[model samples]
Target: MGQRTLVVVPRPDGGFDCRYAHWGVTTDPFSGSRPLGRDWSGTAVCAELDAGYDRLLVAAARPRWYCVCWLDPTLTDPDDVVLARTDDPDRLRERWTEAKSRAVDAVARGTAPDAARAALLLGLARRADACHRADDASFLRDDG
Candidate 1:
């Protein structure tokens, strides 16, 4: 399977709206490329939501391999707007579980270029913290 990524954003309902990201999911995949996951960092995620993107689709257009980031189609390049659709919690959860397994396997193999990132994701997923809701005050504070 190709490297799949999910861009999960916060919903007022206390759940996340996970969207699928089609490219630039990982920089390690490209030789000589600098680490570029900053777009999915916690701060970035919060900033995107704070900018009023709640109306976008919350769930993935389809289940992807890895879950991370929040991409606003309006703020991104037209090429970056790959997929958009309604919510599907079951499928999203299934993908999350699958991605966690993939991460575990990738780490155990000890050969994947993204092994370190996989390990980090595995640790977070183990704690049920990968794509779950964030605490508004600490992690996803919205001062609006």
Candidate 2:
């Protein structure tokens, strides 16, 4: 398996202040995006994850929103990351699980945070899947 990155934007209030635009990049085998993900928006929040096999992802969220961020297209991106954890493994997993559960609720309820995050995460997931097919790194590569 290769390294993966899971980025969790922890907006305790579930609302992410989007006024501060975000940005990122992938430094791996492929430099630029071969099949870049286009700009996306959910519940008025805008996000942009690069279409590269492994790449840049920029997004904004509010406290009222709940959503999980990760590499979901076969999940083989060496750069895929999850939220930073502490020395306590149980606490880390607990936090991850809670975030996911809340996101599901947000999706079902259609309220703030959850709904807002769902919009962006779902869109990002679809785009990531599309990139997997478009770019040729749908799974773990023979060489990392």
Candidate 3:
């Protein structure tokens, strides 16, 4: 089994609640009914990373979302922030544009979910150091 990835608790309405899922506890939803064809094996998220690093990674991997590492915390295990920001507004803007462009390309090509997941994880791991230098710590909550 994989190590603890996030921590979470039951949601009021249930349904694989993504809310607390970032905190690492995934259950049979609030309704407690088994969803048809639900795969809880390889995708099990254990506990919230020491500081919710995985959550941040997941959010950054958002195709239509901004990559914000500062909101999410990082640790020494994988070592680094995913979305390392820069002080230069022009540079940051350029990077954002490039990222959006790449994401568009990926979607256009219909990249597989597994591949997308790997890309996001790897991207954050490689940018870990940079994310720290930028000193951006943030977290995202998917209320939906």
- Of 1 and 2, the candidate ranking higher by lDDT: 1
Alpha carbon deviation, residue 86, candidate 2 (Å): 1.3
Lowest summed-lDDT stretch of 10 residues in model 2? 135-144
lDDT of 2: 0.30
lDDT of 2 by residue, 1-144 (tens): 221221223234543222221222233212322322222122222232222211222222321111223422332342332222123323433444455566556555655653544454454444332222212221111111
Per-residue alpha-carbon lDDT of candidate 3 for residues 1-144, written as tens digits (9 for 90 to 100): 221222233323432223222232223222322222222221232222232243322222221122333221112233233444333323443453455355446755886544544564555445433343223222222312
In candidate 2, stretches whose alpha carbon ends up further than 4 angstroms from where it belongs are 1-81, 112-144
Q: How many steric overlaps does candidate 3 have?
A: 22
Q: For model 3, where is the 10-residue window of minimal lDDT? A: 56-65
lDDT of 1 by residue, 1-144 (tens): 333433454555654544433342332322322232332544344344421221222223332222332222222332211121214433544554455455545656664535544454444445332343221223332211
**How close is every model to the real structure, measured as TM-score?**
0.25, 0.24, 0.27
**What is the alpha-carbon lDDT for the whole of candidate 1?**
0.35
Error of 2 at 96 (Å): 2.1
**Top of the candidates by TM-score:** 3
Candidate 1 matches the true fold with a TM-score of 0.25
